[model samples]
Target: MNASVLAHRSMLAKGASGAACLSFQLNEQTPAIFPMRQVQEVIVLPAQQITPIPNMPSCVLGLTTRRSRVMWLVDLAHMLLSQPLPSNIRNYNVVIIRVAQILQQQNMLVATAHKHVLLGLIVPTMKGVVRFSPDLIQTPKGHFAPGLAPCLRGCVLQQDEMLLVLDAEAIARSPILQSI
Candidate 1:
């Protein structure tokens, strides 16, 4: 099958939450909702360990080691828009996402035997957890407010404000990230 088809089948789909909810606060305004199952973990890293990658874009915060794996943590505030990060930025959380794709070598697709599926992305501050409904999502259009559109899949309107659900894939491929 093709990549899109495989992605559709392999991508984490929302399942039953067992009555427990997952939640997070973005900009202290909206509560981002996500299924509990998809979350791998929420970690706090030392500020010094995050090495700066010279010549990298502003959004690329540099590499972070989690679970023995070096992950490139992207400042969601800088990755999304120019909003200020939470006061103890060193204690921020990184959201790691899983992606599956066959590697291409010299323009040819590598077979399954040589293909590799891996984790991508590191978003700061995972507030908590909340159940999300796919039907409630609505993708934004037209001129977006800065970096919001590229990373945001849509917004879930709440009694207080709008929760922005980020698209893991889009965030990984964002120009700001690839330039790193």
Candidate 2:
């Protein structure tokens, strides 16, 4: 876990209320949140930093070194929005996630043996941290984008706006990303 996020978690654990999460703008369009537990770090990565690989998933932006270890970067817009990201962008807003969710339907042994996976998600902008009760998350409406449905935990209303709460584990395990 990132120190900043750990601090945010601790602060919430003490006196603050609800689940702490970071809300980010997906392609500077739809709003979404990631539970703090899955977030390792949030960074601004220059376009030049990534080393492009051949014959990879379209969603994969490429690999970038983070803390001396190489991590694959995925364009969240390309994945969830099912749209091409603008090529004119100069930098990427990356949210590094460490996925180690236990598979509930799997046998206990296999679930227990699961290792943490690292991947960087690129978003257009971040909306800052927010706290919302788990019960507040609701099923997406019929009009919701199909591409984003599987990766979503649910939706929540924040200041009268619908904010999608994403499941990082599901995003990390996405089939398009799996091809990388």
Candidate 3:
């Protein structure tokens, strides 16, 4: 297994904490992180599963089925940078995310409400998981692309590299997703 996977598994074994985060590259030059609490799973896109949706935003890649549930796939790079993944590229990596939690009430008439939605984010590469102390994360400063600032939680410096931590819930609730 890769170092990232090992790191991720080790963190999972350590139990839930804000210090654990999944790290992945948005592109060759950009690295980002997501709180592990929101990530459900990560997988490589199967060749035949991606069914492209027509007339949607360029970022909307399409939909795919995973474990009997339909997942909407969006290209994070395209959404943030307005640069879609190259057409010639075939393999894709996706991070499955659960946006929120559902509250269950036994006596209530409406026992089940659609509590949270699953979203699949297509990224150029998956870097595995990294564990950082909460204190390491610094408040976001400096300028960011207007499109990306809203979803960023903050940034952390790791091994001399800075990684932007993203809030998956914010991305899931973004107006861009609702507009489609």
Maximum-TM-score candidate:
2
Judge candidate 2 against the unseen true structure and give its global Cα lDDT, from 0 to 1.
Answer: 0.81
Provide C-alpha RMSD values for all models, in order: 8.4, 7.3, 7.2
Q: Which ten residues in a row have the lowest lDDT in candidate 2?
A: 104-113
Q: Residue 94, candidate 2: how far off, in angstroms?
A: 0.2
What local distance difference test score does each model get?
0.56, 0.81, 0.80
Residue 148 miss distance in model 1 (angstroms): 1.9
Off by over 4 Å in 2: 1-16, 101-109, 112-114
- Report the C-alpha lDDT of model 2 over 10-114, residue by residue, as the tens digit: 554464788888999886558899999889999999999989998998888899998788889999888888876688888888999987745556445344436
- Give the distance in Å from residue 113's predicted Cα in candidate 1 to where it truly belongs: 10
Sequence-dependent TM-score of model 1:
0.67
Across residues 1-180, which tens digit of lDDT does each residue of candidate 1 receive? 356533432332344322223456545554564444445556666667787788777666677676677777666665666665654655556666544344668999755645323333344446555544465566643465577676666765433456666665565666676555
Error of 3 at 80 (Å): 1.5
